[model samples]
Target: MKQGTIHNKDRFLNKVADRLNRKRITEEVQLPTWSKQPQYEVFDGLSQDELLDQFVLQCDAIHTNVIVTEADKLNDDFDKVIQDMGGGSIVHWDDPRFESFGLDSALKKQQEQGTDVHCWNYQLGEANIKKAEQANIGITFSDMTLTESGTVVLFSDKGKGRSVSLLPQRYVAIIPKSTLVPRMTQAAEKIHEIAKEQGRMPSCINFISGPSNSADIELRLVVGVHGPVQATYIVVDDK
Candidate 1:
């Protein structure tokens, strides 16, 4: 029996599978990109430092303990925050800053101490979906920020995943001052620059304004509708 020649029974199964595949793809295409539903808050002041201060204040107001520290202090602060949040897990990319920021070692220790520290260097959407579906906190990095609108832009490149931003019920993004731009328009231009240099555009560029929110029927406002209940911007101190 030549393997290249399909039997009648196999052909019938293949046709059924093909129809199923088309139906699955059709459902995916019909699914919506979720509406514009975020409780956006623009912190006052213009500088990165100012925005960071306001972010800390907002976190404090929401009763999430603030953990501001030096690069070396990330471990202690991170551990405390994760523990306070009920100790789920932390995930990272292949980026070298995990060590530079001193999070990799601390998180590993936490995992060994009965916490869950899961690391995957690829497929961010799947990773995020997993962590979001199970973990309490999902940690990742960001490419830039918009100080004017108080927006964080997580560039979905080789390592940084967009799901790392969207899926997690609680998202903590590590962004330094060097990547802070002033506006959303600039974010698109930066994307264009990267596209021109890389010969193609990346698959996703996330501009997160704030946690998910909505004003539905009767104009009643509600928060945390589709995404995380909390989104905190942890600005690592360089000094």
Candidate 2:
């Protein structure tokens, strides 16, 4: 990707500093310490198993199916999810973790059985969006999970199209145990660390909680109004 250039960045900052009756400060500012940190207190001492239980309960409230399985059995569980969703065309991200999590075999098997399987291809560009639109299901690995909200965080890139999750009729997120956190507070901190380490940020970061729903029509709740009608999370015990 081409790096963006800032026009007169120093001039802009200098003007702001001048208005504030101070010179431009080049030093890093220290973050203020808060007196009470209640955000960290929720699920602070919970074990991973406890967090998983909470996550499952939250998912149920949101109408999302949660499947807990071992990494070794991910292939079978994934296949079952596909079958349950009424297998047809499927699209997934171009992420190698699918193979690491034992899902590649399932995807390959589906293809061999004449099921349409499309992996997001950067080279194909807009064609990838078309495939996602035509797909019955779209799959992706969660970059970070918020157990409090039953949310799956996705960092979109060239190979990981946002359409893979939004355009499909159904969405599937593969969540590793280690990726689960107490809530968005922890997820935001991790994302800040990633941006600092990488010296750049992803084009898009999506925090999806359950299926697409809206209450716009006569104040009645409607599902799948703007995105996937059905969503599922397969949590792998890979920690």
Clashes of each: 0, 0
Which predicted model would earn the best TM-score?
2
- How would you encode candidate 2's per-residue C-alpha lDDT over 86-136 as one tens digit per residue? 999999999989878768889999999999999999999889999999999
Give the CA lDDT, 0 to 100, for residue 169 in model 1: 68
Q: Superposing all C-alpha atoms, what RMSD in Å does each candidate have to the true structure?
A: 11.1, 1.6
Runs in model 2 deviating more than 4 A are 1-7, 18-23
Q: Where does the lowest 10-residue lDDT sum fall in candidate 2?
A: 96-105
Best by lDDT: 2
* Ten-residue stretch with the least lDDT total in model 1: 37-46
Show pairs that collide, candidate 1.
none
Candidate 2 steric clashes: 0
Alpha-carbon lDDT, every model? 0.64, 0.94
**TM-score, one value per model:** 0.68, 0.94
For model 1, what is the C-alpha lDDT against the true structure?
0.64
